[model samples]
Target: MKIWSSEHIFENPWELVVRAQWRKYPNKFNQAVEGIDVVDRQIDSKGVLRSHRLLSTRWGIPDWATKIIGSDGVGHASEHSAVDPRNKTMELKTRNLTFCSKITIDEKLVYSPHPEDKNKTCLKQEAVINVKGVPLGSYIESFVCDHISKNASKGREAMDHVINTIKLETVELQKEAKHAMESINLNFDI
Candidate 1:
């Protein structure tokens, strides 16, 4: 088993960041994520929103993995997330369902408003890479770990890009609202 974790602080408020999370899919930054289908969504008794999604991703695996998982290079994962507005926290988990006979990837994320800075948010991400059905466990583990690590780096960059785009869009919307208010005020004064 290989473990990896990351921590990131976003300049945007937690609320905005969480809201933008829903729109992150289908963005240019997340090109590898081919599709997402909402399997279930509902607000629990505690008012926490819960959702399950089936995500399809197109990923290229290495030669050794290709032989084991197949050569077509496509994988699917199940994602589950919860939004707790009252607690100002969002939690998510993703697990690869394809090629389980060879390997499995389980990822979890916990997001919350920064304790010191209300305008910022903190994200803690962890992933467990489990390789199975191999006698040379150590050697295969190293290679699989390296691949997941590289893929994770790309995923982090893409997430940052998506967040920045959301921030820009928010700023533009604020500017438009300000202009509309000013125009309305001017017309009323005249």
Candidate 2:
């Protein structure tokens, strides 16, 4: 299924803050944003899948005001999963501030057997947006140099306006989607 995707390139530190905030708290409102659940498996040198449970948890800021005020989160939950050879890793290095940006949203519905009750199943459809960037300009060449001084006073106001608008749009879209899903009887599990 097609998923809604949105992205903005950040040229100024203030813009970066906004982008980071959205990335850090895509579901700050506790809405179940759609996406695939990845279960990673690790492989040993002998090419055998390891059977150990990777236990990890990440913590995050829980205050709406903090998000609105542009306060970054406190901690990140460690990802719990096994690593496998099927995973691909790419490494690229460059001087800061030279890059392109892209965001992709994917939606899918999935079903898996309940861990506690073998006979039961769980169904969830998620919308996930992945973001990537490569620097496009030097920090000095970008707006940072010219706007830094003014940003101290103007950043907060601009951020508040942008964030408020985004929050409102998210709420309306979520409500509409939820209602449509319910109307089709696809909002809950079978």
Candidate 3:
């Protein structure tokens, strides 16, 4: 009924992070174990299947959070929209679930010329993700988290390589500039 999950961010070219979790259901569809009467099934404009979170509101919350926070707390909710394939004009509301766990990543890096020397380069950076404990539906969350973490790690590696390459290019440019000045016999006034 309960699951554990975690996510990590990687240092990469494009921003990326990975997450992992263990859950009972594989995805949104499997959440409803007991054969809930198929009230409806349809596709929306975007061509996505829509389904409701079958679990009762109470079961949706993680057992851990409830123990610490003591009920009376609202869980996180997600909404998805899909265009009805039958009508094409009407949109179906598919896949709405409440989760307790949450994670976010923030990356900010820049490469710029040094303030005093235009030819010199500088690298600035700050990146990380903050995650909080939350209830996830079965093993579904775990599967997704693992996949994301792997992708993020790869991205981080690529980004680090790019940063190094940029640094080398900056140094080469500075050297070329110096050589050009010497070839022109430019006299330094100061």
Candidate 4:
């Protein structure tokens, strides 16, 4: 078994960081994540939004590991998340569904406003890995943990790209709306 944890701070506001997280897929930075499907979503009585998602991913496993596992490296994981707007907090938990007999990876993440800077967001992440019935289990666990650390950096880059895209889209929409208003005013003046 291996445990890994990390903390990071994003310069963007908490709301924008959380928003970017929802749209983090399909970006150039994290190509390993192939797809995401929302399985369920709802709002609770206290106004917290809850969501369950299934993620399809290819982790770029080594050739030797693939040979040992006797299968393609493609995998699926189920994620459950909760967002509390009132408190400006987002929490997510994910667990692998594939290769359960040989290995299991469980992850947890939390996003919240930075205590020192309200405009910044702080992310806390932890992952646990266990390998059963596998040779060199400890080595495999260490490799997975290292891969996760690298992927976490890519995840941040992806979030930055998403946030930039969102800002650009917002600006474009505003310009379009302004143009429509001007056109309507011109028609009225005629």
Instruction: Name the best candidate (by TM-score).
Output: 4
| Candidate 4 deviant stretches above 4 angstroms | 62-67
Model 3: per-residue Cα lDDT over 16-69, one tens digit each: 111111022223322323222334456546674554333232234467857775
Ranking by lDDT: 4, 1, 3, 2
Q: Model 1, which residues run further than 4 Å from truth?
A: 27-30, 62-68, 182-190
Clashing pairs in 4: none
TM-score of each: 0.84, 0.23, 0.29, 0.94
| Candidate order by decreasing TM-score | 4, 1, 3, 2
What lDDT would candidate 1 get against the real structure? 0.83
lDDT of each structure? 0.83, 0.35, 0.38, 0.94
| Candidate 1 residue pairs that clash | none
Clashes of 2: 19
Between prediction 1 and prediction 4, which has the larger lDDT? 4
Residue-wise C-alpha lDDT for candidate 1, range 1-190, written one tens digit per residue: 8887888887878888887778777766447788999999999999999999999887756678677755567789999999999999999999998877787888898889999999999988888888787788667767767766676666656667777877798799999999999999999999
* TM-score of candidate 2 relative to the true fold: 0.23
- Per-candidate RMSD vs. true structure? 2.6, 20.3, 19.2, 1.5
Please identify model 3 stretches exceeding 4 Å from their true place.
1-137, 186-190
